[model samples]
Target chain A: MHRKLIESFGIRVRQCREKRGWSQERLAEYSGLDRSYVGEIERGRVIASIVTVQKLAQALNIDLADLLTNCGPPSGPGRSN
Target chain B: MHRKLIESFGIRVRQCREKRGWSQERLAEYSGLDRSYVGEIERGRVIASIVTVQKLAQALNIDLADLLTNCGPPSGPGRSN
Candidate 1:
């Protein structure tokens, strides 16, 4: 469940970045995070802190709520939203 | 800016917990986190990881997006939304 949660968040980050036509490197640059770190996040290799989440939201020009949408454990018993 | 951001998140956590009339210890128990850790999060002394945030939101019975509302840096210029 934890793994799924992290992976979903990474997917969300990638989706938002791609929507903006920005590369991972571009996101790193805009968010003042390391390129490797951004890559790790997108790959779901790291558990990002709230501060990191805020930086990503700011760089992506999205609200924190929007950035976090659909990024947690499966909502319902049989399936997730 | 980072300090303010963490502080706001802490404030939000405190508000939610209080609204539910749950003590910090109860929040920790429900979230499966250490009591001290929950206290730290509520005091703005730590930058909680995504997992921690998820746990808290689940324990509070709130959506992640709703839990994060008003938890980041203020919006707009000179004034925050």
Candidate 2:
């Protein structure tokens, strides 16, 4: 479940960034994160800290709740709100 | 801004736990995290990783978005969804 959630989150991040026409490097610059780290996050190879997530949200100009809730299709019944 | 956000997150966690009549130790147990760590999170002395936040959300029986959004009174105008 955790792995699935992380993967979904990565996909969400990628979609959001792409929606803004921002490159991984551009997002890294805006979020004060490493480009490679952002790539890894988008690939679901890494899980970010809450601070990092907040930075990404701020850079994307989205609310934190929106980032988490609208990441993908609704999660499974037992796993979601 | 980061500090304030963390503090608000902590307060939200505390309120959620209390509403369930669960002790810090119990929340820690359910989340598979350490009691002291939970305390630190509640005190806003630590910033948790996304995975940890998810664990806390699951333990609290709340959605991740709700945990992040409903933690405190609405954030300032510049903040919040």
**Candidate 1: clashing pairs of residues:** none
Give the CAPRI class of candidate 2. Answer: medium
The sequence of per-residue lDDT tens digits that candidate 1 reaches over residues A48-78 is: 9888998988777766777777433212232
lDDT of 2 by residue, B1-81 (tens): 788878888888999888766789888988899999999999999998778888888777677777877843322332111
Show model 1 residue runs off by greater than 4 Å.
A70-81, B70-81
Candidate 1's residue-wise lDDT over B1-81, tens digit each? Answer: 778878888899898887666788888888899999999998999998889889888777776767777433222232111
lDDT of residue B1 for candidate 1: 73
Pairing residues by index, what is the TM-score of model 1? 0.83
**Against the true structure, what is model 1's DockQ?**
0.61
